[model samples]
Each structure stands twice: as C-alpha cells, then as structure tokens.
Target: EQGHEERKSGTLSEPQEFHSGFIRINPDHPDRVLHQDIDNIENIRSFISAARAAAFSKPVIAIKTGKTAAGALAAEIHTGGKQSSDAVYDALFQRAGMLRVSDLTELFAATQTLAMHPKLLKVEQLTILTNGGGPGVMAVDSLLQSSGKLAQLSEETRAALNKVIPQSDMTSNPVDIFGDSVPARYQQALEILLHAKEVKNLLIIHTPSALAPSEDYALIIAQTLDKLPKMARPYVITNFMGEDAAYAARRLCSNYGIPTYRTPEGAVRAFMHLVSYRRNQKHLTQTPESNADDAKINKHAAKALVNEFLAEQQSYLSTHQASQILAHYGVECIQTEVAYTPTEAKEQAIELGFPVALKLISPSIPSKSEVGGVVLNLNDAQEVEQTAFAMLLRIKNTYPDAIIEGFSLQKMAPRAGANELRIAVKTEPNFGPVILLGEAGTGLEFAQAAVALPPLNMNLAKYLIAAAHDKGVLKERVLPEKVDKYRLCALLTRISQLVIDQPDITSLELNPILASNGQFLVLDATMTLSRYQVQSHRKRLSIRPYPIELVKQVTLKNNTLATLRPIKPEDEQAHQEFDQSLSKEDRYKRFFGELPQFNHDQLAKMTQIDYDREMAFIITQDNATLGVSRVLMDPDKIHAEFAIVVRSNCQGLGLGSLLMRAAIEYCQSQSVQFIEGITLPENTGMIELARKLGFKISRDFEEGSINMVLALTPIDKHG
Candidate 1:
C-alpha cells in the first residue's frame, strides 16, 4: 500500500511489495531488463531493511522458490535476472530477520506457527496432538528431519492426559487421538493437555480423512482454544487436506487465532525457530554485566591494527599481525617468529627454545597443513633449517607462481589430549554478529556440535562455555591435577566478547586448542578479514562505589556495626588476610581442602560472580573482616547451598549467624530451592546457629559435620 502511494506520486524509488500472507519477494514484473536501473543493490538493501524491520516488530517468515537454474530462469523471466535475483533475495531476506522456508508447505507452516505463538518463554518442553497414526508418524519424522523435538511427557502431564484418552491410545507425547475420536473427545483431550503443568507449547495435527469430518474437528478445536485462558499456551495447527477440506480447515483455524499450516514439517520448523528466539531472549534478560578489562585489552590492540588494515584496504592480516591480535585478547598462541631465511629460521628456533615447528608463510595459502606447508617437531638448529627449506620448496612446487614471503618458526606445544575449537563469526541479515563455538575436528563440523547464539554479553558467553562439550571434559578430567575451571570459563567468555566486538573479523579458525597443565593454548590460527574491516572498539560500563547506606542497614551482634559493600578484583591482599585468619581445620572444612595459593580463576569466580543466583558477602567491623558468606543455587533452582567461613577470633561473636541470616534472607527472596549446609558435628558453633535459625538438621556419616537443612518461610509482614 505504501509502495503504491509512492509510485503514484513519483516519489518512491524502486518500489517492491512483499506477498501479504507469505512475505516472499516478487518484483512488479517478471520479464524485465537485467540492469542496475531495474534491480540495483540499493533496492535489494531497502527490501531487506523493510523485511528486517517487520520481523523485529512481528514474526516475519519467508518461503524461497526456484532451486534449479531452469526454475530460477523462469522466475527471473517473470521478475528480473534469475541467478542474481535468488542470491540477492536470499541475502536480503536473511538480513531482514525473515526465516527462509525451503518449500511452499514449509513456508505456510512457518508463517502460521509464528503468527500464532510469536514468542516462547521456554523451549525445552513441548506437547503434540494428532488424530491419525499416519499423520502422527509423519509429524515425528518431520520433527527429526528439522531437528525439532518430540518432548518426553512429564509423569504428571502423562497421567493427566491419560485420564481423557483411551488406554489403547499412546499415552506419551504426540498423543494420537485415533480414528474413533469425535469433536467432544478432541476438545476434552485438548483441555486436559493444555492444563498440564509440564506442557509449555503444543502442536496439533488434524488430517481430514473419509471417516472424520475435518471442518467439524476444526470447529471443536477452535471452540476449545477460545475457552482456554490467554496464558494457557499457544498452539500450531496443521491440516493435511485436498482442496475443499484444506481450505475450510485453514480458514477456520485462522479465524480462531490459531496459526494453520498445510504440512507438519513447516509447523515444526517454525516452532523450533520460536523456541530458539525465546531461549535467546531469556538469556539476554538474565545476563547484565560486561567485563571492562577484557574490552580495554582488545581495544588497545585492535585500534592501531584496524586503522592500518583499513588504510591499506587489506582483506586479511599476515600471521604475525594476527598473532598480535590474539595476544591482545589474552589468547595463548604458539610461540612464533617470522624468519626471512633458513638461517633466520634456525636462529628463531633456538631463541624460542628447542623442539620447534616450521611453516611456510604465504599470503595466498590459508590452510598450510593441506598444502604440506607445515613441518612439526623439528628439534635443534639443523632440524629447523632443513624443515624450513623443505616446507618452502613444497610451497614453491605446489604453486609455482605463489609468493613465498618467508618461513615462520614456532615452538611446538606439548601434545596433550585436546580438541579443535573453532570460533567463527557469520553475519545474518536479521541477526548480527553470531559467534559459533564447536569442537575443531571433522566430527564436530559433521555433528554441528552444540551451537549457541548468545547475544554479545559476558553472562551469555559464560553460559555458552558451560554448555560446550569441553566444559564437561574440563570438569571431569583436564590435567594439572586441578585445572582451573573458572579461568577456562573466563577465557571462553572473553573470546565470545572478542568476536562480538570485532566487526572487521570475517572468519576466524583456531584448531587444536590444547587444554593441559592447568592452561589452554591455540596451536594454529587463521583470521580472515572482511572488505569493510576496521579496528575494534572497546566497551565500558559505568561503575559506581558500593552503596554504603544499604550496607549499614545489615548489622551484627547488639548494636555492633558491620559494613556491606561491593568487592574489588584487586582485593587479593585483603582476601589473603581474611583467609589466613581462619584455622587450618576451619579452612579445610570450608574449602573441602586447601593448601595452595588462590589463582586468578578462583578470585574472578568469587569477586565477579553473577549476582542473580549466587552472591558473596563479607561481615566486617572497623575494617577488620570477621567472616565471609556465599549463596550458591543449582541451575534448575532445585537446591541451594550456603557456606560461611568466619574468622576463629570472631566465631563466638555470632558473626556466622549474621552471615547465615543474610544468606537465608536472600534465598527466600529469590524463591530458590531448599537452603542446605554441611557442618562438622564437632563444629557446635555452626550447628547452634542453624538451630537458632529454626532449621531442620539431619546427621549423616560421622566422617564430617552433620548436614543441615533449612526450609525458608515467608517473613511475617504484620508481626
């Protein structure tokens, strides 16, 4: 409509209209001249911008047609240039935040599902309803094909649904109503399923057949949906029909606020997309803090380099330059030096220490190993010289006209059991700066190992790291006897931010990220640059002094003063003082066991921990630290642990109870799981505090303290 007005007034430039129902791009005429005047890049950009804006406001879905060249040519004849048209449309639509549908059926389903339930609060739980076994099977197949899930029904939901369905019918998720189901039965089944506590969203499949009246079923479904509460749940309905029944079912479902699709596959795809978007939204709302130091480090290094690269208009940086960038981001890369000659290679190898790796450095070749440009485990000067010469010769033979800049001498890192970690950035038209992390091996690429699109935040970064496969490996086995999980998590967090902040990055490949001996290092790296490459910018979030007024309100003992405050990262010295004040026995009891020094990882986890579910508080009087308390919650909110470490000198002063009281109050406010604590049976001080706090104590094995449990009750308002 806007385009029509602009065209009539001769004010609009290159008017294009999207299909009303399916958001597919179609130019005004099919047969047209293939030139900039007809279909220019600017027009494409405008189209993309419009689509993206619509998607942001409401869910915009697209179905792309014309896969074969012939089909494309036909489309072009009806529109403009075939090949260019498809490419341009795809690039534009993707940027505009429209989900591309593979087929007509998929397109319909995606639009229908998205239109009905545009947003999701949770993605893990799903419920399905189908009338016939054949359609149910097809729905299951489509789900698997599109990576959609057939969620396992919770026991409670299963029991509830079973009450309304026959015993012969499948009671699990994807509840098949069978051929005998009538309008009344269908409505009752839907009501019971919707009311289940575990079902977050639902997918209904209604296949009109000879026996069942499809329109009648659709009417019943509509009536049931109308009776459901606004927040009961959202559902996608798919009706497989031939002409008359399909049209009737689609119109009926659409009229009643239900998104209707013609096929099951389309519905599943759209549902999965909704699920993903919901997950991202939840993550964005949860993670609030940004690491300023990491930003500063990256900015200081990226600015000058980005400026130089942009000035030269270089699409990619040399290995040496790339290494500098990695170092700036605090990523550990192999020890490397650019050597102009064999002698230089030997010299650099010796300087870097023995057992070095030699590689031919060429601007043209990105994958050195594939081209036989890499030589590993070259010990001594002679080995380095020979390997460097051989590598250079191999490069020369592989590409006779290739430019051989020089050789790179790098110290070979110890071969430890490690995984390939590739962090790449791919810009989607609608979604900006997607950071991908996966295992580096062929299997990872094949499996598409756990991908998370965390929206450029440190907390999301941490969550991504925790979700990765390497996290399990680090927790269960990584070496140095006790690998620093916190430090590794921080590294992942920093890497995510680096990719998000740096726009000049076209693609980055880091293979064989070795996690060994309590540290991680990058063995090889390749960083590609985009045409619009520019230096990265630093991000800073304002920080103010801790609120003193709020801290003073928290008190200990009869009128004794205690300060509440925010902790600084540089408080390691004071932390040590607080630690040393505890008896060896007390320290062991608190830490499980501890004798070594606290590393940066430990400090970061303690000081920069997320304040949402976990928090650390210190009780102090006149600048003298009395004790520290920490509240930890399980991810599922099923349980919480409160651990307090008080100074031996301050034990009997009721400081432990003060910290415990604060932790309990916090847990109750968060509506967290049960508050639990463990104390040595002999630690009568802690036991007494628990008893005074009205906790239910339970004694376990005699090896240590009795386990204490506290059930929080709402504080009385009118006491």
Candidate 2:
C-alpha cells in the first residue's frame, strides 16, 4: 500500500517496496520500465537494503523462486526479464539476515513458527516426542536432512522416560508415549524433555487416534509449557496430523503461541529455519578482530606490479609475476623463475635445485596440465630441458597464435600428506569480488567450492572455513597433522584486505595451495588485472566494509592527542565502561531516562554497527573512549537521527563538538537531507554545541526538550 501510494504520488524512484508482511522486489518486472528508473545492478542491492531493514525489526521469511535452470528459463519467459545468478541471490539473502524457505508450505510454516516463537533456539538439536513411531521417524529424517541434529537423550533422562512411557522401544530420543496413552502421558513426557538440559527444541507429533483427541493433547502440551516462565525452557513445537482432526488443535496452539505444523517434516523444517536465521543474525552482528598483519603486507609493491601489467595492456600476469605479487601480500609462495628458452629453464632449475617442476607459461593456456603444458619431478638438467622443450612444442602446436610467455620453473612441492586447497577470487557483476575456497583439481571441486564476499575479517573467514567443512569441500585428516585453521583464517583475511588495498587486481587464483603441518605454500597461482573504476576503493562490495579511511587523529582541548574513528566491535568493553562512568543525571539527560546496565547483546548492538546505514564515531585517548557521536539514517536515507554523549569525566574536553562536526560531515557526504536530534532542556552544553554547529534550535515547553535540526541539503519546495 505504501508502494502504491508512492507510485500514485509520483514519488516511487526505486524499483522496490518494503512493508510489514514481506518485500517483493522484481527489478526486471516489465512495468518497472514505465514506473521506475533504469534497472541496474544497484537494484539488487536496493532489495538487500529493504530486506535488511525489515529484518532488523521483524523476522523476514523469503521465498526465492527459479532455482533450477528450467525454472529460471520459465521465470524469464513469464516475466520477460532475465534473472541474476541464484547463488548471488542466496548470498545476498543470507547477508541480509533473511531466512529463505523452499515453497509456500514451508514459507507459511516458517512464518507462523517464527512469528509465534521469535526467540532463537539455544541449539539446533530437536527432541521429538510422538505417540506414533512413524511420525517421530519422519521428523528425525527431516531434521537430519536439514543439517540439524537430533537431541541425544542422556541415560538419566532415558531412565526417567522409562518410568512414564509404557513401551521399552520408545524410551529413546523420539520418546513415544504409545498411541493408546492418555493426554496425561503427553504432559509427563513433555515435562521430562522440557527439563532435560540436552534438549534445546522439542517437537511433539500426534496422529489422529480414538484414544484421545488432538486438541486435548495440544492443550496438555500448552498448559505444560505455560507452567514454566516464558522462554525459560526449550521451545515446544507441535505436529498435529490430519486437517479435519488437527484443525482445532492447530488453532488452539496458535492462540497459545505455540507453532503447529500439519506434517512432521514441516515442523522440523521450521525449527531448522529458526536455526539458520539465528546463525545469519550472528554473522550480521559479530565483531571480528582487526587484521593485525595487514601492516606488514607489501600492498604498495603488489599495486605497483599490478599497475605495471595494466600499463602494458596485459590482463593475465605471468606465473612468476603472479607469485611475486602474492609474496608481496605475505602469501607464502614457492620460489618461481621464468625462462625465455629451454636452456634457460634448465639453468634456472640447476640454480634452484634438482627434482624441479616446469610449466608452460602462456596467457591462452590457463590450465597447463590439461594441454600437456606441464611436467613434474624432473630429476636433472637434461630432463628439465627436454620436458620444457616438449611442453613448449605441444602448447605452440595446439594454439599457434597463443601468446607464449615462455616456461616457469620451480622446485617440486612435497605432495605426501599435504592438502591441495584452491583459493580464488572472482568478480560477480552483482556482488563484486567473491572469494572461493575448496579442494584443488578438477571441475568437480570447483562445483563444490564454498564462496564468500571479500573484505573478510577473522570471524567471517572462520565462518567460510566452517561452511566449507559443512559442505565437505575441505576436510581435515588426522594423518598429516591438523590444518592450522587460525593461520588459514589469517591468510584468507589478508587476501581479503589485499583486494581492498588493490582494486586493480580483478581476479586471482591460487591453485593447489599446499596445506601441511600448519604451513601454507602457494604452488601455482594466477592473477588478472583491470583498471577498476570506483568512487571509493570499497564501493565494489555489495555489503559495505569497515571505513578505515574515516579514521582520523585529533587533539583534545587539553592538548592531549586522541583518535576519532568509527566504532569497532573491539570497543564494546570500553563503551561499556564509558556508559557506566556517566553520572545519573548525565545518563538520564542522554538517554531521556535512567540507563540500565547494558548486557552483552546490547553492547554488541551499539558497537558492531552496519557502516552503510549507521555511523558511530568515537573519540578515544589511550584505551578509554572519551566521547561518541552516532548518526542513524532512516530507510529512505533522506533523514538521519543524531546523538552525542561525552564521558562525564571528560565533558569539558571539546570532544562533543569535534564528534558532532565529524558526524555532520559524514551525513553531508552521505547526502542526508536533514539531521535531527533532541535533548533535555537542562542539557545546556549540548544545546550550545548544536548552536555552534549551525543547527536551528527549537524548544518544546510541553515536552520539556530541545529539538535541533540541521539542513545538510537544500530543501525542495515541490515535494
């Protein structure tokens, strides 16, 4: 309706609309041409913005159609518009903190489930309680298929269940109370599972039976859950089978704030949806450690080499050139030497050592081993020379016009127990630079690889590693010693920072990066260059990265040096301390009420903010936060709300003025039309600061507050 209003008022500029139910944005809709601007890549990101904004306040259950090739074609034909890569859509939805459901059944099931019990589960494990064995078994199967776990009942819990459940075979995880049991039996079984420390989510399944009605069983479960404090125990979900008999029970469960599904699979899928939603939300808010090793990286040298290749109008960098650039970024690369001729290759091999590897270096032949362009384990100079000569001949004959950059010679890597991991970066039109990691060799591995967008921190890198492990892409075998995951995460993070530091590098591939005994050796690599055009270096990312460029050094009024920068996740502790140091009156004035002690989640929400929609600049000296200024833009991006608070101990240091100025400049840069803030009338310092910053101050005597408004952009008269 809001979208309709905007369209009717001639105010709908973007091809997207967000509301309470769900946002349906089709950039390629045929009507978009008449009603919206030119559809571009930004349309997808605009959808991301809408989804994320909605997700912030409520759970967003999304249904992404056209997953298969046939479905995609059908959608294109029906809508008369092409679809972007489904994988890109998947990544965007995950990044935006939206839970994707497969069909309308799962969609409504998940929506109802989340809408009723919005609290996240403590664990992904589901403890099934069923009167029939078949529905319990079905629920178990669905749970495992969804990559979820079945709650393992402890021996003590099983012993307790044996006392109430009559059948011996039903004493396990999916405790069966027997079909002939009464409603009291279900209440007993539910209480047992509800109090079990191992159970995080409980799903009770019931089929129609003459022994007891489904509504009676649902009432008992509801009453049992109500006995405990709200959200104090594992969440209880119900699978009341059959439409005719289960209809009243389902409605009763809905009124009692319990999720009910018609099928066991639906209930389990809804529970797993909540699990996925929780994980995605964690990824959105988790604060990652800063990459401490980036200072040691030779970004300048890497940029220079990439620039040199771009200056020469060459896209592909030679093997040795690529190795050198990787080395500059602190990625351990096997020493490689380029030779113009076979004799030069032999001489280079001799200089390096015996038992070397020789590969044909040509822009056209990307996969050297595929075209007989590579030879391994050459023992002596003669073997190296002969192999190089034969490889050159084979490649030259295969592609007569292919640019042969000569041969690359390097010592052979010890292949015994080492894992060959492929790490590559590719630029997608929608998401920009994406990082791929998986097992090396063959197109099959490429198909199974896990991908993540760049600008990764330690936490995001760990998530990528975990996701790869979950997908069976990268496995850790006990034989060769465990792969150093921390080192690997650091390396991935460095590679992420490399792209941020040097945007000219359009693509990079490190094939068969050997990982053995906590060591990573880049065996063979390739890089492609393009003169990236961007207003800012990080603009290519679909999700905005931390704005390191905004960090600045400033001096306080007391001549003490301080740093004014965007807040980081690492500042949560300091922010807590800053919040606690404020006097009662100061806190009340700042918060407009008595401030409560912030919990971990609240502190995380304050510190780990999205840089795209919100900006929190803090003035810090040493290890303490002296002051903070935060600006939060609304969904429209035209108006922003501002807040500033200086530490009570450091109130007279001119920090508030500095932070407000910085925030105003930031709002101006973002093109925010108006900046608005309010403060108690007693807060004369803040009101004076607002006046100094060119803000129009208006007093509200009824509300006993002062409203400060600053127009960053000229107001339009036509609106």
- How does each model score on lDDT? 0.59, 0.77
Winner by TM-score: 2
lDDT of 2 by residue, 175-236 (tens): 88878888777788889888888987889899998977888988888888889887577887
Clashes of each: 10, 0
- The worst-scoring run of ten residues by lDDT in candidate 1 lies at 1-10
Candidate 2: which stretches are off by over 4 Å? Answer: 1-15, 18-41, 73-84, 154-156, 167-170, 243-248, 287-292, 444-446, 535-538, 713-719
- At residue 449, what lDDT does model 1 achieve? 34
Model 2 lDDT on a 0 to 1 scale: 0.77
Clashes by residue pair, model 1? 30-77, 30-78, 30-79, 52-96, 95-429, 95-430, 420-440, 679-705, 680-705, 681-705
- How many clashing residue pairs are found in candidate 1? 10
List clashing residue pairs in candidate 2. Answer: none
lDDT of 1 at 588: 74
Candidate 1 structure quality by residue, lDDT tens digits, 1-719: 00111121111224243311112222332211111112222233234433433343344455555656777666567665423434334333433445565665544444445444555546555577887777777778877765456777778767776777887348877898777777777888888777776667788887776666688777877777777777766554455445676777777776676766666665666567676445433332332233424443565466567667767776665556576777777777876688899989999888999788787777687667778788788878998888777777777777988877787777877665543355544543222344455555432331253344422334445555555543332134454354345655566656555654565676666665776666777776667666543322311111111222225345556666677543434445577678777788887777667676566545554654444336677776766677888887764455788888888776666678777777777677666759998877777777888898888888877655588898776443110
